[model samples]
Target chain A: MFQPHADRIAKPLLAAAALVCAAVLVLIIAVIISGAWPALISQDLVVFITDASWYPLEGQFGMLSMLLASLLVMMIAILLAAPMGIICAIFIAYIAPVRVQKIYRFAIALLAGMPSVVLGLWGLTVLVPLVNKWSPPGLSLLLAGIVLAVMILPTVALTSLAAFKSLPIALQQAASALGVRQHVQILKVFIPAASAAILSGMLLAMARALGETMVVLMVAGNVVQFPSGLMEPVRTLTANIALEMAYATDQHRAALFVSGLLLTAMVLVMMSFAARIKGHNDYG
Target chain B: MAEHLFQFVIWCVALLVLMVLLWLVYGLLDHGLAKLSFEFLLSEPQNAGRDGGIISILVATLLILAVTLLAALPLGLASAVWLAEFTATHHFWARKVRLALDVMAGVPSIVFGLFGYAFFGIFMGMGFSVLSGGLTLACMILPVFIRTCEIGLRGVNNSWRQGAAALGMPKIKAVWYILLPAAMPAISAGLILGIGRATAETAALMFTSGYVDRMPESVMDSGRALSVHIYDLSMNVTGGDAAAQASALLLLMIIIVLNMLAYAVTDLWLGRRLSNDLA
Candidate 1:
């Protein structure tokens, strides 16, 4: 804490910290590309995407089932989170008193940092057992979906909060001034204006849900085939990689990396898509 | 008439949405409440589905948590201080660079695991030890540290900065001596939250820190953090029957303690001063 020579030391230390953060980022991207590129460039992309069978023993490696399961989880998660997240944001932005809003928002910030393992444990001991009681055996996509919805809620809600705050409050007031009812003002004005942020939030939720590992791995039941319906248990791209990586060797490990490689490419595309939506908001 | 009906519909929607959050809390707590026990805390993993303790995982988890927090705090604060005080806001590139951190936050945890595996585990040849894993975990948690610290540091009033400046202190001194102390409570709040995140991270550690079921002998000893142990136990189902509940309870109890310590330190610090107005 002493500063006799603080100026000289502090500046360089701060610069060095920033440099390490940069190095880590570059390091992460470099590792992913290097690990995955061997599979990406060598194999034909279409056969990987279109073929449903992922049998290592038969020398066939297809990612369709895993991707389908992750997508299914994403679809279900967003279905549950988006509506609630949007509504909660609207309530905080338009309806709640300042004190209440502050409390709610703080609670949400805490939830955002909550560990996935905790949530999965909550699901395993809580939701999975609940589902198990109703069916002969439990563990299904519906259960996983319900768990993930709550998981992604904070991201979507916070993003929607930003969107609602940035919308034209003056226009909202004018609408109310003209006897455009509060709900009418919201539905007609707020939702449309805030769509960009809402969509970005949804995209982010998809990225997270698709990539989520422990929760899905613990609760997803790890069934290898494509899910016939929402209630059937299935394995996701991420969970498959995590579950099998320890035992997987040679082709098995590389195949898993190929899945990771595919997932990384998918997420990169979604991230850029979200960025484009964010950029469009500035011009619009 | 339609507007009135719409308002009713919207309010009902709000109530339903809020109730779902309540249900989630209920689900988490009610199931957890019955199984909470101290015996669970003192045991180690055994036959799948049978009763046992996870003391090793718990110790390693706490050790990694401590290491990551101790390592990340100073760097995080320095970055926040540089951004909120030292740098000019008008630089568009500077703003973009800050925004890039948030984008980094968007990257998946599993992706981070890959990064950690490649760089720390493979490239650096740290070989899946706590040092490599903890460092990787710290990096993953850094975006969180940055965002939380920014929230706290930015909350400091401008008058406080100027008043320190008016007292004939050097500009850096004004920040170091005056503003930082004032911002301390807020930054501590963020630090607590970041530490909590670091403790609970599994994906990032999985790739870097391979599971070692022994006590962490040193920073370099590879160990499985608690979350990964929970995942490992729950999925494989090798342990004995009663142990699952005990293990769950133990994991829950450790996390609850982690949360309380984090909350208590921040709450106490803020209660004496800013009351978390910064966040």
Candidate 2:
């Protein structure tokens, strides 16, 4: 008798706790939108996309250079990380011995677990100096891209490993029976089978690179410019907010929120795209 | 010859990945370990961290972590229970919850800092306290904690539930006694991972916590997190690199230990389960 009543209370309580997640999401969107309302209404959207100057105090809220910088840095990161990470995953899944594979996986986890700030610290002290020898200024899009690549490599490798592990063993066996070479089988059969999951992983990594703050702030040199080359300094949308948020007020503050809103939208769009791919994979 | 060349390239790539990890670890240890000492761990900063130790920063980090876990753990566990037990997998509400979690998980830490500043600092008026920082971290990490715990709970055998129902066990009672105990390893693993993340965080806590290096009097007091301290010491303070290295080493050790603990918990649990099954 008492147990039934307890169950009734407990079930609803648990559900209410679960509903808090959905509520939090709604609240986040509401808060960001409201914070950004002033700038959103004040400025034309084209100004954000077309104009490159970002002098917030003088009332010019152009973010085009930073926007392009964010995308370019992410592109550099993806271009460098994707092939290397996928190859690492292939080596682990198909080539490495069992003991070696386990160790490699653990190393990858340790890499993933390293704080972003620490990576930034390394980039600041070590990588930046190393790049300075050739580039004159150590902090640039190329250096940031390298740091970001290291940060996201584990994500790509881990996801691709899962993708490979999930393939039907018979597929490999049939390929071998047909006398297909190992490289040929990997290049043709296994990669094609796992492309969707691998693509999703790369997409997630790109989102992470775009949203990354401390690393870029430390190593990207914080110059708000359209980079003409890989070694040129540039600021991302994230770094802009972190750098300016402390003293920004009024329209300046609102503009930071606008940047935040743009970042949130970009990350959400990429996440949803990745989720859709994963969902399609699950069903099809 | 081609196969050999391909194998050589793969081997080189694998070695390169290993070298990166070693290089990072070596870099930190080489620069940091010489500076680390008992006194360094237990003292407070002086002259803007050019001298003295990180005891106050350590306290603030722990207090913030405590507040975060205190808030996030119960909510995360309850939500996981609800998702794994009460809701059907394909239910509309369940899908929405999962979607919300995915969105939350993908959100950048800096945005959480902005949200925390706007919501907790300004609107709610918590204002740069440990409580505000911890709550922001709780929000950021809740999705991760929930997903891990839910996966653990869902991995429980279906027959365990059926058997409980057959034995006339109350749903709550079975979940409390059986399902939770059975899922303890995963739950503990998830908890450790959450703790690791909360400890290593910098951006999300920067504004909400408001970077006061003094020892916090209470949750309401502003406290500087270790990550924030490292960032400031490395970037802002001239000649603060030695102290920053020491602090980074300490933070790195804490995260590595927590991660190892997570792995150990899962492995121990798996070993026990195997032995019991054989018996």
Candidate 3:
């Protein structure tokens, strides 16, 4: 129970709490810069962009390939997730009976709530080994993409469900009344209207894939160098930081922070789009 | 004929997507099928990382959730109280603060990890400590706290507020004695979600808390959470393949149960409130 006094003091308390959030941001940025200043100032950002070498002891910290590896993962994962998630939403919203829809929603709720670690373990045992056997070098970018796709499916599915459900129920009924098949009604009416939510969900799913750390750390093979095609082992910024931060020091550690900063920058941009989509959806 | 072609393509895509989702669930079952042992979950990490246990991790997961709740509840509830009961809508700074909190909701966990490592681990000298990780998680999920509480408070009927005011009750007293009670159900679910998020969180904890594979006796003890522990034992033991599989099975079951508990608790609590209103 919150028992606030009827006084200016209560006002000060709120101001103070808000101030704490800013203070946290400031403190975090300061510490990262100070700790990682060596790498930030000494190592050229170009190396991070162009070079493929990432051996920290030798000071070769190029991450262009790793960056691409991450991008490739996000790209493939979204490809795998968005359409299915959209269809799943359609099934739940239009095709399924009420009982099935309830079950689908509950399943989604569980999926959303499941820890990433479990997903990582599943990926490591099932996805990684299967890829390793069929694909060359097995633990390649494609493997990471597939695992990440599953990892983020619930996010995309649930948000798209929200999107499809947000449409006026009459719209679907009207489409059905016009002799449109269930499938046609989905694309012509449901998908278009729900596009914004679907798009935002896709972005959030991509964001989840891009920012995932431990799962990628485990299954992405921890190779910091470039991918030799789709089957080549590679690294991601989140994985790079997670794998090395254990014993990293000086320049090595700061570079990890730089990676973290890069991830946050990307996420901030991604989240703004999420907010914009959410905002536009809210107003609608 | 044109509709048929488009439908063909769409159905092909839909069926492909459906198979992929089923494939995902099958993977979950495949990894976790054999290792659902109560004893394995109750014991500690042992036997050279494999065939040991997940008890330490289970303890750490709950411990982090507890610490996060302790750290966040006071601050979040305080902020919620201000915005809902005390502050004027015309207050520019108050609106800005809420907006900032909303934006904070979007900052990625990686940034929180960096900040946790720097501010709490280094600056605060809570180096690689559980408290640091918990506090970092608290900050990360605070927006959920505020937003949920706002909903709960708003759900309290306006007549309650007016009635309290007419009775010559103090604003602060009214907030505590009347409104919070009515809103308790909604607010409690928010706390549940925050705890769920905290328990499952890893990246933020990865840096601020070192992964000591032992039970934390206090908030300051550095330790690996269940998720981090699962990541470590499974990934770190790739060279010894069998042991990794043993732990993965154990890890998956624990995660399912934990997720279910978190979700059910929130749902039941909220649902009960809604039901009571109907009668």
User: Which candidate number maximizes lDDT?
Assistant: 2
Query: TM-score for all predictions?
Result: 0.85, 0.97, 0.87
Overall lDDT per candidate, in order of appearance: 0.72, 0.89, 0.73
* Two-way DockQ contest, 1 vs 2, winner: 2
Give per-model CA RMSD: 4.4, 1.9, 3.9
Error of 2 at A37 (Å): 0.9
Which ranges of candidate 3 are over 4 A from the true structure?
A1-7, A43-47, A173-182, A280-284, B1-38, B88-91, B238-279
Per-candidate iRMS values, in order, are 4.3, 2.1, 4.2
Best by TM-score: 2
Put down candidate 1 lDDT per residue, B177-264, tens digits, no spaces.
8777877766766776676677777887886787777767887788878777766655556533234444444554455565566666
Total backbone clashes of candidate 3, pairs 3 or more residues apart or in separate chains: 1
- Ordering by TM-score: 2, 3, 1
Worst 10 residues of 3 chain B by lDDT: B239-248
How do the residues B20-136 of candidate 2 rate in per-residue lDDT, one tens digit apiece?
Answer: 888988888988898899999898899998799999999999999999999999999999999898777877887888888888989898999999999999999999999999999
Clashing pairs in model 3?
A132-A138
User: What is candidate 1's lDDT per residue for A106-125, written digit by digit as tens?
Assistant: 55655565678867877776
* lDDT of each residue in A175-274, candidate 3, tens digit only: 8789987666777778888787788889888888898876777677777666667777778888887778878887888887877776766776887797
Q: Which stretches of candidate 1 lie over 4 Å from their true place?
A: A1-9, A95-113, A129-137, A166-169, A279-284, B1-34, B43-52, B90-100, B159-171, B238-279
Q: lDDT by residue for model 2 over A1-284, one digit each (tens)?
A: 34566678888899999999768888988998888889889988777768888888689989999999899989988898898899899999999999999888888888878888888898888888888998779899988999999999988999999999999999999999999999889989999999999999989998888888888888899998888898999999999998889999988888889889999999999988997887652111
